[model samples]
Target chain A: MAKKEWEKRIAFLGPEGTFTELATKELFPNDWTIPFKSIPECIEAVDAGQVDLAVVPVENALEGSVPLTIDYLFHEADLFISAEVLTPIEQNLMVHKNNVEKYEEIESVYSHPHALAQCHKYLYYHFKSVPLSQSSSTAAAAQFVAENPELCVAAIANVAAAEQYDLQIVQKNIHDFHFNHTRFFVLSKRNDRIERDEDKQQIKTTLMIKLPSDRSGALHQVLSVFAWRQINLSKIESRPLKTGLGDYFFIVELLEDENAPLMRGAMEELRTLGCSVKSLGSYYTYHQK
Target chain B: MAKKEWEKRIAFLGPEGTFTELATKELFPNDWTIPFKSIPECIEAVDAGQVDLAVVPVENALEGSVPLTIDYLFHEADLFISAEVLTPIEQNLMVHKNNVEKYEEIESVYSHPHALAQCHKYLYYHFKSVPLSQSSSTAAAAQFVAENPELCVAAIANVAAAEQYDLQIVQKNIHDFHFNHTRFFVLSKRNDRIERDEDKQQIKTTLMIKLPSDRSGALHQVLSVFAWRQINLSKIESRPLKTGLGDYFFIVELLEDENAPLMRGAMEELRTLGCSVKSLGSYYTYHQK
Candidate 1:
């Protein structure tokens, strides 16, 4: 079979039916999509030129940052963020369709650790005695339950997973918090400027910063440049530099475009203070309603 | 057995033979230590006055902060950190004594997700085909391997775990990072000032700060208060406030005594700026050789 000329290839973190896949489908409806088992694999596909773009979850409202995606982007890949997608996360309790009537008899529950933790209160209240197990992902748990009919297990995943794996939803929206959402990044090898949709798109620039090791207030100095310019920062996260303990490089995301003069000035000032600054990308964000 | 007047009870995150246990033993050599299955349980036990103090790992050099410990302290428990213990981590590969000769035939490896991740390169290079499973803790994995000798499973744990479970060490120091260290906090119900050990002890004050939501450069201003006074921050980590996405509270550790005039001035300035500041504790840190 030959692919159509207009159909672009996209890769997402999945075994299928994961939130990343849902975000991919929403973003690239007509594109040919492929599923990679892990975040690194998804990013590698784009870096290897196997796919035109890759979509992976970078942060969850409740779970915080996904270290793998952040670390890979900072340390390994030369990828750029083409766009950001915000998807609402709804975790559900699902069981195999064949065992729908026996949902109460489930002896074990399975989910990705984050998903399990998000629904900790619910699980503790309802299934306190059931043995909880960790799966590589929520979709993997659903797939496992789909394949093993004799094992009375329930998986905490999204509604898509339940439908894809032929599982019945025993409970819906079981996550502890209502404000659950995950931010996914659309990664590409090229640093092409994203086309902005007026009134809907907002520009964001993410910078990886390393401060001078000996400085007493290096981080404070770095933030001052942006502070004086009134550049609003959406987030600032510190990741280990991997050299040793107490050594870190920060990831700062500013609500400004890459070409903004203020941002450029901040970068210049930071560099003057012996700080290493790398621009991850300046991309437009899309909210999935 | 009834406890003696001089002996105090302490709770740790463990089923026994964990790195936390090793840290507990070093910090309180004569205390009666109890092992709880999880971090929350250990902290809760202390909060309920079941133990004199609780020892829990707060941060690791390689893996970053232990969120459970941080979140529990910030949200649930009204406990204060009495002391900090820095322990070097050494992960090893162990198996049942009966399976020593059949090490090559091992079908699966089990360990805590962090331990398994720490030894990722080693496992990928040597036991690429072996299925890696997650256990509640590294010690729990060792105990499982010990009890199930017929199952050719290996556990990545500490040397203490191997000895406690009577397992054979197939490989030693398999962790990828040599500078691996875990910071454990000795938590107590009362905010008792720790006696300084003079030369070896360094006083650290940890503050939990929540910025007024509407302020633009609130974090920058908060840092400026410390920056101008030259208060060295050992670490600054942000955990979700859990009210919504983008809402966060910072856990800042400063290298100064709690009652320092500069510290008091900074706290007062922050409070005047409408920022809520809570002192988690001011404690002395001990390094275990």
Candidate 2:
């Protein structure tokens, strides 16, 4: 295989072991992966020429679209979605190996609040009446369990976090959903001119739209344009306009390109509906090897 | 003042000085407010009869909606929204009094990822080059800064956290949006029955609907019911169904109770559109005294 370009540093939201970090590694293998503090910072870094690209989670299979990601896109119209990747999620119940006995006598489970919530059913099924210890994140929870070996405590985290902390996996894949995956968008300050192969399948474009009011059929009027053109819409969501007076905004993903005639017609119809829409970007989904 | 008859025990998601704790206390005065690791656990305690009520965030004025709150509601359908409270979100940049000189030569700012993002403009305008350190929550970040006073570090957190940690406020109200407020839902397992008074200004109900397919005007057909009845919709969001093939699920909120004759007529018309609709509950908004 030919060598890939490596000067492009891919920035992500993280501190060593967040799911974003894992997704970064999976997406750009050769590029340098640097973790920023927040999604806006990551996007700003890309905007200010500090980094070549950034990757952030747009939506989750179990939870929904991340509001931060949506708001950042709607507010700052500079960043664009270059590509999309989905990462499968797996959560583990972990404890320090030194306290193997404590596992059997576990009185409470400690984890990042979200991790604990995701695996709530499993914990309740096993330890029906035990108290839960909530930590900031899985890594912190694992670190806590690692230090407090004398206590009967368990942590729910990813297996990678467990390995990094030198903890043993007490249980595995404890999330309520079987196929939990997080959808991530790869963003770059300069769009990479990657040529599409003949085998490229489905195409999707995401846009943010602000309607006149919360009037009924307003959204329908916007969707009908795509319907008339026979273009399928993959997703539609409403977010607060943040302009006060109970105004609303919508983010939509259409299975068509910006230049497509049908999409152009849809934009015209959306304008007549008195909706202000901005195109985020169009990209093809990447399949895992 | 006469004391209320029900001495409900309420559990909130927090350590001690989290904003959630503050909101919970304000929502239920003269009642017990216990701290829990997570919302799910807190809600579970209420379900198990250990606590009489729980407080969880449903949305934020600036950040849109909290996905975990929505997903938890979908999973735990038995609980109903008893009341909704809006708390103004004011984030402070806090640090040890002795660390003032170090801030000029500071290396990093520690805080929850959300806090960091909300105050992004301030960070970029002033401490743009400094690294950001992500902790689990703002309270945890404050605690970390308190314990390591010698380090050239600061934290973004609420005023209560700063007070509890004995840290001085370096900056105040550093949020990107001045009207930042989080809307919390007071949940109860008792019953949905509530004595309505004419004094109550507005009541909102949330619904999740799964559409038939990706056909043209699919959503329009569903929304026409509300348009015909002139019912106002507060919010609507769509998430992937995660069934491998491209399918989506939509969540909607109405500004009125669907049980009322006019609203019920609108809902009946919506059901005729042939879709799966799930009701969350009708709740009265909490006004500050």
When summed lDDT is taken over every stretch of 10 residues in candidate 1 chain B, the lowest stretch is: B193-202
Q: TM-score for every candidate vs. truth?
A: 0.93, 0.73
C-alpha lDDT of all candidate models, in order? 0.89, 0.76
DockQ of each: 0.70, 0.29
* Top-scoring candidate (lDDT): 1
* Model 1 spans with C-alpha error above 4 angstroms: A95-110, A120-134, A148-154, A168-171, A196-199, B98-108, B124-131, B151-153, B196-199
RMSD of model 1 against the true structure:
2.5
List fnat per candidate, in order: 0.68, 0.36
Angstrom error of the Cα, residue A114, model 1: value is: 3.3
Task: Give the chain B TM-score for each candidate.
Answer: 0.95, 0.85
Q: Write the per-residue lDDT of candidate 2 for residues A1-289, one digit (tens) a residue.
A: 4335755777887655667767777657777888787788888888888888888878777666777788877777477788787777778878889776567678788876767767879887987788888875666777788888787788887766787778899777878877777778888655442234643657788888888665566766676667667787777887877765246688888888877877887887788878887877788776433
